[model samples]
Target chain A: MTTNFSRFEGTEDYIVSEDLRNSVNVAVALSKPLLLKGEPGTGKTLLAQSIAKALGLQLIIWNIKSTTKAQDGLYVYDTVQRLYDTQFGNKDVSDIKQYIKLGKLGEAFTSEQQVVLLIDEIDKADLEFPNDLLWELDVMNFHIPETSETITAKNRPIVIITSNAEKELPDPFLRRCIFHYISFPEADMMEQIIKVHYPDLENTLLNEALKAFYWIRSQHNLHKKPSTSELLDWVQALSAGGISPDHIYQELPFLGTLLKKNQDFDTILRRVHNRGTGENQQTGTRIFRNW
Target chain B: MFINFFYLLKREGVPVSITEWMTLMEALSKGMAASSLTSFYYLARAILVKSETNFDKYDLAFSKYFQGIETPAQISDQVLNWLENSLPPLDMNIDLEERLKYQLENLDLNELKKTFEERLKEQKAEHHGGSKWVGTGGTSPFGHSGYHPGGIRVGGASLRRSAVKVAGERKYYEFRGDETLGVRQFEVALRKLRQFTTRLEGPKDLLDLDTTISETCNNAGKLKLVWTRPSKNSVKVILLMDSGGSMGPYYRLCNQLFTAVNKTTQFKSMEIYYFHNCVYDQLYLTPTCRQSESIKTEEFLRTHNSDHKLIFVGDATMAPSELTEVNGIIDWGMTNDEPGLTWLERLAHHFPHNVWLNPVAETYWESSSSYTIQLIKKVFPMFELTVDGLEQAVKKLKVRQ
Candidate 1:
């Protein structure tokens, strides 16, 4: 438990808040599975990759789906394959060990060095799925009754679980992990994140884009409010389009890149249209007076 | 002591279990807090709080226990009051005849849709009191105020709604578990009904290892793999909710419960129907209880088997005649041939495993003036709609009565 582990200060590509950095470090230090909950595009899954890259460890990602079971992450016994081979091939059919395939968790446990095991979108699985993995996670080992074998962790691979919070995770499973909520980055932090993505971008364009981006996010009725990833993509589009700062707020050149949903698109467009007309009238009167 | 902080979190409605507390202690022992109060706050939160929904409560408890710690700055109540009270000035200029002529000319839906988009692209700035651009107080086919014949309102007064003020408050009272039954809590409670039963005759999707092994051995070492359908939660639900009229007070609670049930993936199938005051001959598909959108109670009972768990959500407080007398339903449009009590009895007898959840408190049940509640209670097991009551009801639903 007192082993000296490398602290995660966040990778150069990823910008993390102090609180989140502390949470990650504590989870790593205590060798507990860190449970990250956040909005869809807040880099919950990417954090695991960042940690893996920062620590120079192998990354094992287990993407969970609705049909995914806890046992699928441990080991799978291909009995059907073995049976098919018995009739079709000349291989040793009696050896059940040949049929056992190591899953993502099993690979991480058996790895030569400590690896980053990322269980991505764990809430996509059944309600009992997390509960089923509780014993394996706590003991850092799982039993294979078919082969009469117990696979124990070689180095207790650092576990990082990310959930979209689609379903409430069982309390017992939650108790065994270190939890952190990755809040949407504030303007200052978001600026840093945008800077990381576009280092040579114009300051005026960045400021205007951030202003418009944050304003769009402020609207609560959006079915899917633009997040960090969308902001980055929108900035890339803006920088590529070579749109001026003045026209950015006026026309909002690439509104499609920010708002994804049709309803959101319509809502923002209508608001922007109304805002634009007001500005046009003021500018029109100013020109008329000057003339 | 930091232990006090744990108790304070519990008091603040964060369900910080002892296991999580011990984990925090272990982290602290490892010097994970780094001897900084801010660091400790983050470290303790990571260990003790599992969900972001509880983070606001944890923050409240943390600031309360650690007092004087720099909690997030909150917006003043005066500012919030000012924001709430300050309504946008309404435009008084109304040219009714001109508006009617414009509307009549632009009545074509296709033309309106095309013009709206065209106007949006052409408009450059917010034009208040304009007739062409998409701005406030415009007679154009777009904008908010100064109505046109077929104008598409861009935004309303609610456009000023801000999430910053909400975050500044940090109350998150809606997410607090102790305050009321949230949809999440209801979903958790309803999840207990997921008792999976694998049918032997269904589509084979899962590998039946035990059967395969025994069969292979019986076939003299020849490998025989068997597949069977995976065990699934076979619980079916029929949710009959009493809507409108007296049930208006508990609309939010009933809606939350309905949303929870609708969200829960455990049940094999679910059917929801609405009624007003009491169940009569017909049940409406919608909460409005319209005569056109209804199904006969006899047809419903005949179609749905007794296997489905019947759940009735209503206050169950109505006029005694509404429950006992014929044609006593509160809906003026239609009359019931049989009393509500007879229908309740029929439903109860059909579905042996049934429960009624009353939004009204249990104490109010005995001293209540309404005889309908007592009469309904005799037909079906009645439970309060509280969290504890829901858990007990779920447990009761599992058992065959």
Candidate 2:
């Protein structure tokens, strides 16, 4: 079973480069889960939705929490509720199917139509979580002990997993998937991405904003660099605030949008202020400021 | 034919399992990656190489197996052009090899920097396969793609690992310490440090259905659901990590441990602080904080209770005087009446359960001449920064009086 998937055209907002499109196509054709790893806010999660939309597949998302278990992804047996009703409440205990709920992964597997199973932030879950899905993901079937029946996918789901590399996934689990690293967009790519969100923003303003964005990102001592999503947010805020290219220095207060961490903001602001005042003592620092 | 490739990868420490091997074979058989060597390379890597840490190792193993397979060295076109250009004839006979070798071995960093500048100005042409010019091959003290005992590599690939200084903008990423660890390894290792107990909260935590069903059956059909949340690891941990300078090499491992511990809600409270080579009179909350914003070491100790666990992450490769003598700090200028040993002992005493995590291998510490490592071992039980080492350290920290 293979997906006759092609590159998402620019008609849709999913403007992906040829390399990424090919990676997705290969993953889809191979029926292997596509695992996306990148910096935060670089659209790791958004890529799943774009792929699903482009391929015309139903999307089933499982946003993982720290306490999320792999069992929760398969099926959760509400034995506590069932027992409670069996003891106190006069409820129908005839059917065990009512007590057993199919989780996001379970739902995707049981669905007759092809679906996209997005296991977002797999790194957020406990380390063993990914390994638990290994057998089911590879074989496309899982057994429910209570029901004494097996649930298998009628059409193999296109699984898309995203990780921030917060914690390393097991090698066994990673081996079962297709991997791609979504690097921060370069100049031309960033322009297209920004235009997707803010279409009417003037060319000069956008150019100046990108220049500042890249300049601040180039700072070696920054705690966390601003990602592509932050760039869009910054440009949107600038456009709404009627900021011009020449007056960008005055809009330094809006830098909080770009630099999320307090230390990063403070460091950048301090350096900029020092450089403006000609108080930078080091020649290396002065050269960086100029660049 | 490609089974040998799998063995080579396994030997290179790539942990390629049989299933992944079969998958690669299947991929090739299906013409999924049979188009070209590059396609096959990507398909095999995507199927077999699991983590980013093993990518370089895979490249090396692949090159070894395929014989002439190159992973595209990062040397620039400009540098390549410069290196390809033949230099005008210069003095061919210069017997400065022994003297240069001695200087490379004995010269201090300050003298090395001086020599680098002098050589940069003296060498005018791009000399290839020569003994003097900073180009590829031969025995030059500079340039890439060549052989020299200790020369500054300009922009070429590393030949002998003797370059004192690399003259270019190289992208440095944090080293991933837990890259090879299995899933749930850290969490399982951290289970040894679970010292807190919890009361039953609700069914939201984790439903005790077996107990609930048994109790209900005994009570003549009265529903009693048992629920409980694992008490958060209530142990207070004051992690004092050394940052900057020598700490740069161990940054990724330190960061991995920090992130892993921070994400777990097992701790009652966790406080992290950064210091330079040695924990002097104070420590900064963040790396970017100035000295004025730092917390006094005395005050910090007083604030955290005596029971707080102190895990110091550092290489512990510093001058002996930094720990034993007053005002021995090499980076900052300050007059300290008390030595670093005194501060460390004071901390160890305040926190009875304390462990020092050294990124440097234990064998290196045993052979090192630095007395700081010796004093640290005497003051606190030291562990390597590896996963097993951390597990052992956690086990030691859990030991009660």
Report the poorest 10 consecutive residues by lDDT, candidate 1 chain B: B158-167
Best by TM-score: 1
- Taking the tens digit of each residue's C-alpha lDDT, what string does model 1 give over A1-291? 245633788989998877788888888888899999989999999899999999999999999999899999999999778778987778898889999999999999999999999999998887789999999999999999998999999999999999997777877899999999888888878999989988999999999999998888886568999988888888999999888888887778788888788988887777787676664312221111100
TM-score, cand. 1 vs. native: 0.74
DockQ agreement of candidate 2 with the native complex:
0.23
Q: CA lDDT of each candidate?
A: 0.79, 0.74
Per residue, candidate 2 scores C-alpha lDDT tens digits across A227-290 of 9888888888888888877877534548989998998887887767776878852344421100
What's the TM-score of chain A alone for every prediction? 0.93, 0.91
lDDT of 2 by residue, B179-269 (tens): 5544346556765776765643434576666776798689777676676575555677888888756776666667667767777666777
Worst 10 residues of 2 chain B by lDDT: B166-175
Question: Model 2: residues >4 Å from true position, as ranges?
Answer: A1-11, A87-90, A196-202, A238-256, A266-291, B1-17, B34-42, B52-188, B199-220, B226-231, B242-252, B273-307, B314-351, B364-372
Kindly provide the TM-score obtained by chain B of candidate 2 when compared with the true chain B. 0.62
* Fnat of each candidate: 0.59, 0.24
> Taking the candidates one at a time, how many backbone clashes does each contain?
14, 3
In model 1, the runs with Cα more than 4 Å from the true position are A1-6, A84-89, A200-209, A220-222, A235-291, B68-202, B207-226, B231-233, B245-256, B280-282, B286-307, B319-353, B386-388, B391-401
Measured over all alpha carbons after superposition, the RMSD of each candidate to the real structure, in angstroms, is 16.5, 12.1
